[model samples]
Target: MKDFLAELIEIPGGSGYEEQAAELIAKEFSRLCDQVHTDSFYNVYGIKRGSVSLESGERPKVMLAAHMDEIALMVKDIDEKGFLRFTSIGGVDQRILLAQEVTVHGREKLYGIVSTVPPHLQDAGEAQKVIKMKDMCIDVGLPPDRVKKLVRVGDLITFRSPLATMQGSMVNGKSIDDRASVVMLAEVMRELDRLQYAAEVYCVATVQEEVGTRGAVISTYKVQPDIGIAIDVTHGETPDAPKEDTYAMDKGIAICKGPNMHPGLTEKLIETAREYGIEYQISVAPGPTGTDARSMQISRSGVPTILLELPLRYMHTTVETLNLDHIKSGARLLALFIASLKEGWQEWLKY
Candidate 1:
């Protein structure tokens, strides 16, 4: 799982440009699922048929979703000096742009470093102010003519940070916010491959989640599943962050509860976790979760949805961090829940 996640994080799949990551995910799913396909929106779906026969004449369809897109940049302009000005593709915090290494996906892969005015060269007041993304530029070390020929406006850019394992099972890299969850879904698929399950599982790797849950919105409509579970990342505990606002990194997976999620599905997930001795944390989302769950909930006549989150630190930054154990535990919980689905699982949706 670590090696797979490492390879996934290294790929540049920023927002709408998720074909590469989607293809990789589809390849892995093909090995574990009975069927695999990619939609026009690049949302990859892998179906694992259920072994259990039901009198209802129809097996429940369960959607397991993890977004594949990450926060990135798009080249908005090329200056006369050959510097590239860009805009955020998602919810990017402008404060981390200075001096960061990034790869520009233009005519070809070009390496560059985010540039900012040196502190010594800036005025006293300017040094104290946070540098906005508009003021930041990428220096590709190419002349104006050459840069224009290689890089055009609207080219995607991603952080060039590679995944690094820490002392224990912790790993850090860009895009761990969602990629960690994607890896967890893959683990769930692997577990299901060996188990007899009642519901037809659709493991979906959704795209364009960072820009909005556009991929989930469309994919859910296409699959029209009975239940949807969105795997995502939440804030992890950090020394500087408030303890109440973050979850412990290596403790357990977070099962979210709130208006955006279905009450019955949330309860079933909690029960499944406890029955299987799977460690889990309770997270509260007062309104829409800003995840695929929100979109899935309102799809068609409405789909019952649940949101599971892995604790991650430094989200949307180049050094996003998470614990490997959390991924494993989350996958186990999801697999058990899916396996626990019965012939009359739809009856359990009653509020």
Candidate 2:
């Protein structure tokens, strides 16, 4: 799990440019799924057939979607001095952009560093404020002519941060927000290989979620499954974060409850967790969550949906942190729930 996640996080799959990550996930799923394919939009679908067919002469379709795209930068322009100006591709916090190493995916992969005015040259009161992203430039250590020759306008730029193992089972790296959940999909598939499930599972690695959940919108429509479980990341507890808003790391998966999530499915998930002694925390969302669940719920005639969140710190940054054990536990919970979906299980989705 650790090595797989490490390799996944290192791959650059920013929003609207998820082909590389999609290729890797499709390859991995090919071994686990009965049919694995990438759609036109780069959403990787891995289907596992079920043992039991329903009275309707069809097995229930369960869609498990996790976004593969991460927050990234796009080169909006290049100045005369080989400096690259950029705009955020997703929800990027400008405060973290200073002096970060990045990879410019232009004509060729070029290494660069996000650079700005040094403190020594800063005007009075300049050091007290965060540097705006527009003021920062990616210096590729090349002259103007070479930079223009290599990098063009509208090229993608991804953080070059590598995954680092922390004390115990904790690991921190880039793109852990949804990529970690992607790993959770793998774990669930692995566990299901040993269990007998009745629902045909669609493990979808969705694209362009960070931008606006566009991938979820299209993929859910395509799958049109009976149930949709959107796995994502939530705010993890930090020293200065509010206890009401953040969950503790290393505790368990956070199962969300609210209007966006189906009540019956949420109850079943909780009950399954209790029955299996799987540790889990409850999160209350009064309205729509900022996850694929929201989009999934409104797709087609409206599929019964739920959201499972892995606690993560420093979201939208390169060093998003999470507990690997939580992923394992979440996978077990999901697999057990899927296994419980026997004949006439559609009744469980009713309000």
Candidate 3:
């Protein structure tokens, strides 16, 4: 899982540009699933057939969605000095942009560093102010004519930080937001390979989730699954953050509950966790979860949906952190929930 995650995070798959990451996900799923394919929107789907008899009516289709896109930047303009000005592809914080190493996906992979006015050059009060994205530029060390020839105004840029293992089983790097969840889904697929199940599992690596839940909306309509589960990241407990607002790290997976999720399905997930003795934390999402689950719930007469999250610290930054143990636990919980689905499971989805 660590090695796979390391490779997965290195691929630059910003919201609208996810072909490279989607292809990699599809290839991994091909090894574990009976059939795999990518849709027109670049959403990758891998199907694991159920062992139930054809006489048992159509097997319930279960869709497990994990977005492959991450927060990134796009070149919005180029200065006369050959520096690149960029805009956020997703919800990026301007506070972390200074001196960050990034790779510009232009005509070629160009290395660069995000730059701003150094503190020594700032005015007395200006030094304390936050640098907005509009005022920042990337130094790619190229001449204006040379840069214009190789890079365009709409090139993608991604953090160049490599995943590093920290003490206490924690891994840190960029894109752990959804890539960690993606790895958890992969682990679930591997677990299902050895377990008996009766539902058609559609493992989907969705695209454009950061910009909106567009990928999930289209993918759900295509699969038309009886159930949908969105795997994402939530806030992890940090020293400065309120304890009540964050989840415990390395302890368990967070099972979300509230308007966006089907209450019955959420209950079933909690019950399954208890039955299997898997540790889990409850997350109260009173409104749209800002995840694929939000869009998935309204798909085609409403699909029963649930959201599962892995606790992450320093989200949307290059040094996002996650514990491997929590990922394993999340995968086991999902695999158990899927394996526990039996005949008449649809009836349980009713309010």
TM-score of each: 0.98, 0.98, 0.98
Model 3, 1-351: lDDT tens digits are 999899999999999899999888888888888999998778999899867654557677899999999999999999999999999998999999999999999888999999867778888899778878998999998999989998999999998888999999899999998989888888999888778888899999999999998899899999999999999999999999988879999679999999999999899999999998999999989998999999999999999999999999999999999999988889999988988888778777999
Give the alpha-carbon lDDT of every model.
0.92, 0.93, 0.91
- Model 1 RMSD in Å is 1.0
Clash pairs of candidate 3?
none
Top of the candidates by lDDT: 2
> Model 3, stretches more than 4 Å misplaced?
none
Tens digits of per-residue lDDT for model 2 on 54-147?
A: 6777677999999999999999999989899999998999999998999999899999999978878989999899878888889999999999
Error of 2 at 272 (Å): 0.0
Each model's total of backbone clashes: 0, 0, 0
Compared with the true structure, the alpha-carbon lDDT of candidate 2 equals 0.93
lDDT value for model 3: 0.91
Cα lDDT tens digits, model 1, 172-224, are: 99999798888888899888877788899999999999988999999999999
Is candidate 1 or 3 superior in lDDT?
Answer: 1
Off by over 4 Å in 1: none
